[model samples]
Target: MIKITYKMKSYRENLKDIIQPDDTIIELGCHVGKSSQFMLNRIPNGNLIALDNSPEAKSKMDKLSFEYKNLSFLNSDVRLHESLKKVKEKIDKCDILSVDLGGGYHPDTTFKVYYIWSSTFKPRDSIIRNRGLIDFINTATSNEDMHSENGFLDSCGDMGIPPQIKEFKLWSEKI
Candidate 1:
């Protein structure tokens, strides 16, 4: 399951569909450990490696780490290649990858980050929440009448295709 959305109403909504009990998860941008804690609660036999650059976020997650043996916090910026290498060295496998960079208002950066991390870990499942991505889709598909009749698009539903879908499909296969 790969979910790319404007925003998740709640991160926990579809967690069961993406994770298993013994799955190893790598979560990027786990701010204050709210969703981190939620994922931790769901994975008792598994482990969660959460990365965030914010010291305050790490401070909070440190407390959760103390309480949940399966949870570990890494203080590293996800946008840096060095950080990716650091994470790669620590984990042998990543079963699921969850990313929510907060204030995701830049589609190019979001897509680049998502692509790098997804390609690196090659997680079986990935969930990314970025408003800019949805905005980009809307703008690119506007002239094609891709918007819904209600004038709103739901990322989870069938929101029509972008002009580049044909080329994207072909390019994706090479990977």
Candidate 2:
């Protein structure tokens, strides 16, 4: 259900802002290991926990881990707290937690990056975001998805104003 679009550049920079040698990463939907691979290469001293419900995730990560020394893969569904418990034991307060799998694309493909991140990371330490439309296009295609950029900015605009997307225009002027 998870679709992978590797927006390697933005993703890498985003990770760089927060990822440190001491930090660990937990990607909710590893989907063919695109983000996993990107983030893996970035943090050589740190470790990445890649999780996915798809059968391919295990095999792909197994192959990928061979190249990256600090990577591990787990076959787990982020939706199920029970499934997440063991992974939680290994990685909580992950430096980066991305919800890139869920959407109309995948029904149960980690629809709650916010909730999981809220529970997993300290409020001050957490830097979590969802990879819905913008992230997906940016990740899947080899080019920058301008639509996603606008969408993300538009979303932030909504966050700024009447607290509704309809009021997004109001925030644009404030910015």
Candidate 3:
């Protein structure tokens, strides 16, 4: 799986460059079928398994499945064991794993999904679009900087910190 350590502007922003014509893809959090269609167009012979928990997303995907024979939709949540088990029964393996849950807002959830799915499929490559994770990597500093007199708030950059969070120590201490 490919690990991206920098900030990406959009979800799976660089996927077009990596996807091959015959690469099987499993896309988690396919909101509608925009990205799914793009991937289908790329892989004429390959297959795509698009998974989403939303009823709205499922309705759209159900329609798309009719139009594309190679496309399949699974209404399942990546975070749930039962849901994932159902999804696993449908697909054995894939060449690429693409994930963009919650529009890539929650890094923790994104990491969890990536961990579970990567372990299940063991894809040749993976692309995860999470702003929080990218920002965390971009803003990380050295241990010496973290131990500065000003502390974590002053030492680390502020790219990923949400406005709702007032204090880093308080948030970190919670969990």
Best by TM-score: 1
Cα shift from native, residue 5, model 1 (Å):
2.6
Q: Is candidate 2 or candidate 3 better by lDDT?
A: 3
- Superposition error at 107 for model 3 (Å): 0.7
Candidate 2 weakest lDDT stretch, 10 residues: 166-175
TM-score of each: 0.75, 0.58, 0.73
Candidate order, lDDT descending: 1, 3, 2
**Against the unseen true structure, what C-alpha lDDT does each candidate score?**
0.71, 0.54, 0.69
Query: For each candidate, C-alpha RMSD in Å?
Result: 8.5, 11.0, 10.5
**lDDT (C-alpha) at residue 105 in model 2:** 46
How good is model 2 by TM-score?
Answer: 0.58
lDDT (10s digit) by residue, model 3, range 106-143: 59778666655665666777777777887887888776
List candidate 3 stretches off by more than 4 Å.
1-13, 142-175
Give model 3's TM-score versus the native structure.
0.73
